[model samples]
Target: MSMINTEVSDFSVQAYVDDTFKEITKAQLLGKWNVFFFYPADFTFVCPTELEDLQDHYEQLKEIGCEIYAISCDTEYVHKAWHDHSEAIAKVTYPMIGDPTHQLARAFQVLIEADGVAERGTFIIDPDGKIVSYEVSSGSVGRNAEELLRKVEACQFVRKHGSEVCPANWKPGSKTLRPGIDLVGKL
Candidate 1:
C-alpha cells in the first residue's frame, strides 16, 4: 500500500523557482495545505494550458492558505527553460518541482513505468501531511481549477467544523450533513 496518510515520506527533490533551483521535501511542505499537481513531461501539449489556469488562480488559492506545486519527471533545468520560453508558463508563480527520481510519483501511484512519465494526478495534502483528496486523470483530460478551489473550501470547512461532512456539489456556506442515525437514508 502507498503512504497517503503519512507525513512527507523520506524523499527529496529539487524545484525550479523562476530562475533558480531549490531543494524541497515533504517536511518543507508541512504545516500548509499542499496541492501537489503531477503532470507529464515539460514542453508537452495540454499541460501548459492547465498550468496557466492554475497560475491565474494562484492568488485566490493563496488567499485560502494553499500552496501549489507542479511536478513532473523533467529536471529543474528543463522546467526553467520551458518557463522562460513558453508564454503559457510565464503566468505560473508557483514552484515547478522536478521529480526525476520518480519517488514522489511512485508514492502517489501516478508513475507510468513504460513511458517514464506521470499521469495527471492532483493531491490535496493537509497540514498534517496526510492526503485529504486525490484525483488522477488520463493524459488526454485536463483538470479544473475551479473545482479544486471548491474542494479546498470544503476541506477547510470540515477541518474547522469537525463532525460535519460536505455533501455532493457542496460549496462554501452550503449545508453539511452531520453523521447520525436520524440522518440515515434521508438522501
Candidate 2:
C-alpha cells in the first residue's frame, strides 16, 4: 500500500496561504502540476532546512507551472507562529498546509499514528490529479529540492511527448527512450 500512480480527488484539507486560510483540494489543482511535500511537524530539527531549500527554488518551480505545498500535522496557527519566528520559514511564501485532522495524510497514506505526525512523503501529481511520482523517506531524513525539480521536468516532458519516456537522471534535451518491445534490455 503505497498510494503511487493513483488519482487523488480528495483534497479536503485547509491550507494556510499568505496570511489567509483556504480549503485546497484536488479540484482546485485541476490542469496544474502539484507538488505535495510532507514533513513531520513545524518548529523542529531538519524540517526548517528542507523548507529553506525549497524556498531557494520556489521561483523556479513557479516559473515551470508547478505549485508547491508543504504540509504537516500542525495547525495553521502553529504554522503561522513558526513562519513568524524562523527566518528560513519566513522566506517560504508558498502554501504551508496544516493537516491537524490528518485527513490529507490519510489520503496520502503517510500518517504515523503513534506520533501523530506525517512521514517524509513527497508526491507529484499531474494536471489530471493522478500521481505520477512519489517518494517516502524516514522521519529523520530530509529531501532534495533539486531532484524534485528534475522529476517535474521529466513529468512535463512525458506529458508533452506521450510516446517517450525519461530515463535515469534525465534532464531536458537528454535522451529519452520510446516505449517498445525492441527497447527492452537494449540499454
Candidate 3:
C-alpha cells in the first residue's frame, strides 16, 4: 500500500508549538514543502536525538519554505511535558503534533496497533498536500536531518523544473538527468 502521491485527508489535531497548543490541519500543509516525522513516543531513547538533530536544521529548512511536524501517538500534554523536561526536545521549535487517537498515525500507515505507537516514518509532502516521498524504519534507528533536507531540496527542484530529475546524493547545484522524451516511459 504505497501512499506516494496520495492527497492528505482533511483533519485537525492539537500541536504543541512555541510553548502553546495550536491546531494543525490539512489546510496548513498547503502551499509549502512539509515534513511529517513520526516517532514511537515521547521521552523515549533515540527519538530525542532525532528531534534535536532536526531542530538543528530547522532554520535552514524554514529558509527554504519547508515546515516540519514531529508526530507521535502521545497527547499534546505529554508532548509539552517532554519539551519541558528533556533538554534535547527543549530545542525543538517546530510543531510537535499529538496523535493520541492515532488518526495521523493510521493515515500515514505508520501505526503499530499492538504497541499503540508509530514507526519511525519520515514523509516529504508537496504543497498540493500529496506525499512525494516517505521512509519507514525500525524504532531503534535514527534518521539524519541533513539527508532529509537534501531530499526536500531535491523535491523542490524537481517541482520547479519538471523536466529535470535528481540523481542520488543530489544537491542544489548538482547535475540532474533529463530523460529524453522518447525514453520517458521505457523504464
Ranking by lDDT: 3, 2, 1
Could you give candidate 1's per-residue lDDT for residues 14-131 as a string of tens digits?
9998678998887877888989999998999999999999998889899999999999999999999999999999778899999988989888889999999999999988998888
Task: Indicate the worst ten consecutive residues by lDDT in candidate 3.
Answer: 178-187
Question: Which regions of candidate 3 fall more than 4 Å away from where they truly are?
Answer: 181-187
lDDT of each: 0.89, 0.90, 0.96
- Deviating ranges (above 4 Å) for candidate 1: 1-4, 181-187
Estimate candidate 1's RMSD in Å.
1.8
Clash pairs of candidate 1?
Answer: none
Which predicted model would earn the best lDDT? 3
Q: Which of the numbered candidates is closest to the native, going by highest TM-score? A: 3
TM-score of 3: 0.96
In terms of lDDT, the poorest run of 10 residues in model 2 is 2-11
1-187 in candidate 3: lDDT tens per residue? 8999999999899999999999999999999999999999998999999999999999999999999999999999999999999999999999999999999999999999999999999999999999999999999999999999999999999999999899898999988998896368887
User: Model 3, residue 100: what's the lDDT?
Assistant: 97
Question: Is candidate 2 or 3 superior in lDDT?
Answer: 3
**Residue-wise C-alpha lDDT for candidate 2, range 80-162, written one tens digit per residue:** 99998999999999999999999888888899999999999999999999899999999888899999999999999999999
